[model samples]
Target chain A: MKDHAGARLIKDMIFKCAVCLFAFISLLPLYLILYYITKNGIMVINWDFLFSLPRPIGESGGGVFNAIIGTVMLIILSCIMSIPCGIAAGIYLSENKKGKLSNTIRLCVIVLQGTPSIVIGIIAYLWVVAPLKTFSALSGGIALSIMMLPVIIKTTEETLKLIPYHLKEASLALGVPYHRTILKVILPSGISGILTGILLSVARITGETAPLLFTAFGNQFMNMNILKPIDSLPYRIFYYAMSPYPEWHSFAWGASFILVVLTLALNLFARGISVKWKIQF
Target chain B: MTDRTMLKERFVKWVLITFALSSLLFLFLIFVFILAEGLPLFLKVGLKKIIFGFKWAPTKGYFGIFPMIVSSFLVTFGALVIGAPLGLSCAIYLSEYSGKKTKMFLKPALELLAGIPSVVYGFLGVIYIVPLVRNYLGGSGFSLISTSLILGVMILPTIISISFDAITTVPKTYREASAAMGATKWQTIYKVILPSAKSGILASFILGMGRAIGETMAVIMIAGNALKIPTSILDPLRTLTGNIALELAYATGDHRLGLFSTGIVLMVIIMALNYLANFGIKRKPAK
Candidate 1:
């Protein structure tokens, strides 16, 4: 009996140690990335780095002001294209849970979520960039909005689904029109979740480089026109990092730091909002 | 008056339905466009040659993608080897052993890890992983080993979180019954809990494999984009996605079509995997 008990205790200890070791290993890369980016990236940041346009390849000291502006513009454009469509689609899914059309739509959204972002970029290039006869911010926006669609739709559907059926029933009983009830009561109640989804989708797309590779095609200078090629932070980082110049390498690190910070902040903010406004059934 | 309101409501419902159905329309268009662009390559090169051909030099008219197909599988398999055990153990720990406080802290950290962009991961691979591998292992730092290491980390969140949920959902009564039988904690976990949660665990692994296989940017940055099949984990090799991204910018004519064909191949692989995952999910409740 003593021998069996001792063996069991030893086994338990071994299992515990193994679990702890794996858990620590899982988190190590994230910490290492944060450490490396901050240590290298902080050295390159200055007022000039934030506000100045990128200098020519051989030049040493320029910033990514245009890329920053371009990224924000692309994201805003993508949101404008995606959010209404996504929310409406989500509303349809939540309202009609059991129908042939709803099932097909849900399946499509799931498949889209699983589709590779690069593939979507290629399709977007064919649809938007090829037709436009040039790489444009609009093409990039269209590509990103496609990527954003599935995420937003899924989140909106899940959030709306969680609302008690009785809420809608009550409004209908009080003689409220169906459309008005959904627009005023159901939508307001689910607004926080819908907002959280939008923010998270934005965060997801903000660092996307693959979709924009052929669509936006990276401009060297500041350009505000949506129809024109534009530089984005991710594109800039990819270009600079791949370049042989030491100056460009530093620039890449700085852009990476900024991009990482923005993405992380948006994600956390989304989480914070969701938690704060979690509605009880 | 009521009829007027009814008409307005009907219009709103139709608008929402149209918005909802548009995604399906988009999916159909994507498939049509990809196939329309990609099928020409099969007509020109022949499907068997494209699938079975080992050489992938687009300039030389050798578009055999066997090497790339092999490389993608090897890298994904390597990542699974490294990631699955670690993830499964962590899932077990979180679900079976950790306190609520530990869960609270660790869960958010994992979510943050998931939220971090693939490009950032690629940058980290280029700056840190590549150099480390080059110095210590003695090859181009951008090798299969480095990619596998990064992807192993990348897939951890998917595996751990999903498997954690799976293990948690296994009934408490099973654990108690095992304990009642005088089974030790380790025995209960290995013999009872794992078996019960096998379907969910399997689903997580399938999903992880899908993520690793579809990963493009990070793999391109670290995998050296070599055209040959890797002989070992340390060897450098390119994947289908990497091939597309690397060449698509400069490619035109048949070369462009070839890249789209590669997309068709990747899409089919992902769809098949997803179907398998769905099967696993569907099977779990039945068990």
Candidate 2:
């Protein structure tokens, strides 16, 4: 009996050690990526790097200012396109929980969410870029909005579903119109969740490079025309990192650092909002 | 109800329904566009040749993607080999052994991992993993091993979080019953709880596999984009996604059509994996 107990203790010790080791392994890459990017990227960051535009080839010092502006524009445009549609879809799904239409819509959302970003990029190229006869910020935004749709829809549906059914009954008892109840009560109650979803989707698409590759097509200069080609942070990183110039390599690292910071900030912001707005039942 | 109010309600309902149906319309549009663009290649080159033939030179009209298919599978399987054990173990630790404090810290870290962009991951792979592999394994820095390592890291969040939830959903009574029978904690976990959570765990694994296979930017950055089958872990190879990403910018006409065909192949693979994952999730025991 003592021998069996001793064997069991040893087995428990082994399992515990294995679990701890694997957990460490799981975090190591994340730490290393953050460490390396910060170590290298910090050296290239400066006031000029933030404000200046890309110089011509063979030039030593150029900033990703154009890319930064372009990324912001794309995010704004995408949010404008995707958010209302996403919220309404979410509302419909929550309202009609069990039906063929809801099931079909849910399936479509899942499939859309799983579709490869590059494939979406290609489709956007066929749909918008081909029709426009040029790569445009609008096309890029349209592609990203498609990518953002499923997440927003899912989050909104889940959030609205969490509201107690009694709240809707109370509104109806007060003789509120159905449309007014949804617009005034349901939407306001779920606003925090919808906002969180929007922020998260923004974070998700901020670093998207694949869809923009064939849609925005990467401008070299700082131009603000929505109908014209534009540069973005991810596109800059992809283009610069692949180039042979050592100077461009540093630029890529700096852009990467900025991109990571933006994404992390957006994530933390969303988390903060969700925690702060946790409804007490 | 008055006619005015009734009209307003009807208008709002239709508006909401239109918004909802747009997602389905978008999905249909995507399928139609991709198929319309991609199917022409099947007629030009034939399906059997594209699927079974080994060569993939678009310029020479030899667009067989067997090599890319092998590469994508090898890389994804390699990532699974490295990621699955670590992810499952971590999930087990979180669900079965870790304190609340540890869970608080680890859960957020996992979220941050998922939030980090694929391009940032690709950059890191280029800067670190590529060099380490080239130094030790003796090939161009970009190789199957490097790509797999990066993807393994990328998929960890998906696997760990989902499996953690799965393990947590197992009834406490099962563990109590096992303990009452004089089984050790490890024995209870191994013999009882794990079996109950198997479907959920499998679902996470399948989803992670899909993510790893569909990954493009990172794979393109570190996989050398070579058009041949890798002979070893140290050898460089390209995937279907990588092939399209690398050449699509300059491709025109049939070449463009061929990339869409590659997209179709990838789409079919991902959709099948997704269906399998959903099935697994559906099969999980209700709480």
For each candidate, what's the DockQ?
Answer: 0.77, 0.79
Give the Å error, residue A281, model 1.
Answer: 7.0
Which lDDT value does model 1 have at B115? 83
When summed lDDT is taken over every stretch of 10 residues in candidate 2 chain A, the lowest stretch is A272-281
Each candidate's interface RMSD: 1.0, 1.0
Candidate 2 lDDT for residue A211: 79
Q: Write the per-residue lDDT of candidate 2 for residues A155-220, one digit (tens) a residue.
A: 999999999999999998998889999998898899889999999999999999887888888998
Q: What are the models' TM-scores?
A: 0.98, 0.98
Write the residue-wise lDDT of candidate 1 on B1-287 in tens digits.
48899899999999999999878988999999999999988888999999889888777787899899988888899899999998999898888888999989988888888888888889888888899999998888889899998899899999999888888888888889899998888899999999888888999999999999999888888899888989877789999889888887778778888888999999999899888887776675323
Cα distance off (Å), candidate 2, residue A263 = 0.5
For all candidates in order, the CA lDDT equals 0.90, 0.91
lDDT of 2: 0.91
